[model samples]
Target: MRRQTARLYLAALSKYCGSRLGKLLGVGCGNGEFLAEASLKGFDVSGLDVSADAVQTTNTLLGREVARCSTIERAGLPDHHFDVCVCGYVIEHTREPLEFLSEVHHVLKPDGVLLLVTAASGSRPVTLENALLRTGFRSVEMMTSASRVLVLARARVRRPRPLVSVIVPVHNEHRTVARLLETLTAKELTGADKEIIVVESNSNDGSRVDVLRFAGTPGVQIVLQDRPLGKGSAVRQGLRHARGDIILIQDADLEYEIDDYDSVIEPVRTFQCAVVLGSRHSGNGKIRVFADQWLLGLVFNSGHVILTGLFNLLYRQALKDPWTMYKVFRSDCLHNLKFECNRFNFDVELLAKLIRKGHTPLEVPVNYRSRSFKEGKKIRVISDPWTWVWACLKYRVVSPYGGDCTRRTENEMGDVPDTP
Candidate 1:
């Protein structure tokens, strides 16, 4: 029965890695059945078993020194030495599954494969699959056999798809909310996997109802904020619930084009910078708002230039439009920033804190169309400039260890309830 089981597992492993001869490491070579089968199938095999007697028996049976008595966590094996590592029915026995799997990960070559077999009766299967994903394994497959399940995961040495969280802050703009949501969900932006989290504040203008229309859509989450917190607050709320590898700020207003999302995220994907900002005034003719087009536009555009210049001077980073609504950053960057601004000053605080952490944001040219205040624009010309100036200076001196400024609620912020 043991030899038959070994042949069945070898068949499955052969399906993925092909019948090619390579090095294989078995975590628990009980009585040497599996490694013996691998050896017959043209693999140079080594193994680790907890029992010294079992190791000696396996070595004697194989007629070579193939099995070692060692724990997976402290296997003392050289790195990048094995092409495949097999842990059959051994993960549940390990006290530290993650650490043990990480050790396996460290030992495998760049394109190495890890095959895990566990009983299907308990929570072990689910827990093991989650552990594989969290440990930087690229592709994970779950297959079932008689009374057992197999998890085949491949090691990713370098690049992997970055999961993006698109935080859309919605207010009273009933006219464009639905269209915005459609654009976000209809097309795949950046060619990278992403999820949309819409944080809706108290909008009496039916914008909340419009967003609820897409509640049934996959990857679309509608978060309802009880009060009229500012856009910054809504974004902060979304950040707490985001599970993506990258955090991208999306505006609900129609001023920023959704088509620019690819360009905004490209910098991070190419590894040029950890943070990226979409600039409207980057000499792109596609930029819909020009200084000569509208007087109010010119004033705000000039203010943006001045503020961006001040950020460059103080932060020693050259960013053309620091206040641009389209900002894409790595999720880990948030660890250095204790976000407090529940309003427009959130962008200012983000720029200041990121600069203080010594990260320079790469600016990418993207299309933008400025909306007039009469067309549901929210920023106040008189007060916003002062807020931005104060936030930029204040965040530079404040330590991130001071704790996050926003409060969290027990509500399922990412839950999309039954669509009403």
Candidate 2:
């Protein structure tokens, strides 16, 4: 009865926090009962108990000496070492519960979750919530059962969060290049490490100078091309230098808003998706185009719909706008495939390659502001459409260099690799 109750509560608590698998520190580990159950559930379990006998017994039973004879506040564990900190029926007995929580918070990595279980009296949920928030927790919630109160709180910032590489491909975007850098560098990205890699192609408008201004800035890499090689080539170069868990593509132009960055990176961060593409056609059914006042607008919209329809039919996937500049994907998806084109066909190639690898991108509605041709809009109606169509057909039928012609089912297409 005792082990069952502890296992049930711990399982529920772990699920409520995030997952059952991580480096877990169980405060007040008594006889290794709960930690044993947690270890079976895939947690890298360790323990702290004030009783030396209890700690020794736990270490003996678990077959390894993971349990230490120490209290929560003075356990002397390494900082930011654990993905989760669990205190079951220990906080209530601590001389200083606030200090205990602070210690636990210190040991947890940024974005790590802390689970607390205690008798459902004395320290009410309201008090516990305030205490946790005051000690650097971003959010806190409590669940009540017949005899226990379970609290879950996530650390405000992890010390070493996964880096997100932002690849900006630019050509003659001198006007907006500075603003783009400022926005990318100055934004407060919670629970994320950031790297900015800017690939600037040949531009006579002093765009190189604009990019050079951030030359020595931390976490920023600048690549200047002597001659214009097209956006695809610049992006491919940027991807080569990228060192991040998540790769995000941004345009040098200001048409796509930077404020949608959170939404763009969320799906990949939460592991809910392997690829997310921002759709210019997603929200309100209203769109902007360089020639909205002319027939070009109608032509562009029709082309988008027809091409997108064909893409869906061929790949058997639903993608709203595959041409959008705001595409975020896991770094692994780029593996085992080679990019041939260095032009705008890059977009079609990217989508086709990902689909062939069984990665279907989810579309998130993003805000878009169109620029007129006089306002520096690129891409002509006649030539680019043919290039896009050819890319779609070529990749759809022919095998990419060093790629498989046999398509795998969705299950075979693995998701993001697990992070311990």
Candidate 3:
């Protein structure tokens, strides 16, 4: 199982590395744990550790030209020195990580790969390298999880873009579920592995009758909530069973356009980010015009903007629309995330929680359409928004990751990455 996961991690890395056997540089590579593993796989490898003792250990273990070095460039390596340079866990331990990364970029060939992995130091979005985007590169790809960091970048210059996901949260949205399914089925599903998961919560609504409707589809699945959970619970519930390479939360209602899917999935697909938010209103004059439930939709979206913006300001991270139903994420990166809300504000709470958990949401635009309260719309003018706001503020104001992971993982069966 451990070997299987390492292969998956390697296969995933090759999507960026583009080579199997090539010159490898392990920088600040103490004791050469990660590097030794790679060298054992039969690649020509070398190590440069900041600690003299660690460098001696690497030479003893791998019998490579391990050297005592403080910087990547002075490691006595040749120009365009390596095919891939891997600097794991040591980036965060440095005062000038970019200087380290710059040394890395200088040593790699034009087609060379740099796999730099770091753990999030604090529960905040921006980190060491993000503070120095212009040191030597124009575009890059970064993949992050609750505790891991992975980045892909170029040394010279080019255009940069972000990958996106379409998130749709559903509770008992069975009535119009087929509209969403058929619309996605009719799109250009051939180019990418697009997916839709219908979150069927503990619905007393006749919608569950409609949920069992799509049991035969190949890509789409209906995930039922455990216990009597809420809309957020259903969304959280479905995520456990979601198999999308990238997760897009799709509502059963077909009010949104099927054509808008491509622009949304690109950034994350290209390794730009982990979460991509689909915005209903963005980049003016480019508007989505709709008629039914016009006034209520307007009020709902207006309230949504105010709520999300307030959330961004409060959380200390730049997240847009904390309450939007359509949010997307990379499937593997979301592992081990704990959500609090059993209802709607779960989006708001999750956003703020991610901010504290050292992640951020990249907002992208999408079309918006809403139905009347009589037409199956669920947002009510009661204390619901207040409940969401309180949860958002409370979680944002506190530290959430200090909890015990073993206790948390005990109840979540598939939440942890299984090596096999």
Pairs of residues at least 3 apart in sequence or in different chains that clash in candidate 3: 162-267, 163-266, 163-267, 163-268, 164-267, 164-268, 167-249, 167-326, 167-327, 168-249
What would the per-residue lDDT of candidate 1 be over residues 1-420, giving only the tens digit for each residue? 177767766776777678656899999887888899889998899999998998998999899999999987777899889989998878878888778888888888887998877765674433454566556664554555335667677786643677889999999989898998888898686658889999989899998899899897999888999988898899999998898867889888878888888888877765557688888875532233543447776677667777878777877776767888888987655653577888899988876776655467788887777777777789877988899888877776775435532111113112212110
What does candidate 3's lDDT look like per residue over 1-420, in tens digits?
133433444554566546567777777667665566666676677777767888887677667665465666566567676777777666677777667676676787765666665664462324433432434432344555656545555444222322122334555666776566666656664246655566666566766666667676765666666555666776776766665556776666666666767776776565566667777656442232336556655666667667767776777656544555666665544534566677767777666655655557788877766556676666556778898779867886654543523111222222334321
Backbone N/Cα/C clashes per model: 0, 2, 10
TM-score of 1: 0.60
Candidate 2 lDDT tens digits, 1-420: 157756655655655565647898988888887788888888899999888999998999889989998886776789999988878788877788778788998999998888777776575554565567556674454556445666677786533566799999889888888998998888766667889999989788989989999999999999988888898999999999998877999988889988888898888776667689998885433465554465666667777888888888888887778888888986755754788788888988987887765566888988898777777877876798899888888888866534532222223322322110
What pairs collide in candidate 2?
110-157, 110-158
Best candidate according to TM-score:
1
Ranking of candidates on lDDT, top first? 2, 1, 3
Let me know the TM-score candidate 2 reaches against the reference structure.
0.59
Provide the overall lDDT of each model, using Cα atoms, as 2-decimal numbers. 0.76, 0.77, 0.60
- Provide the TM-score for each candidate, comma-separated: 0.60, 0.59, 0.59
Cα deviation at 181, candidate 3, in Å, is 1.7
Each candidate: RMSD to true structure? 15.7, 11.7, 10.9
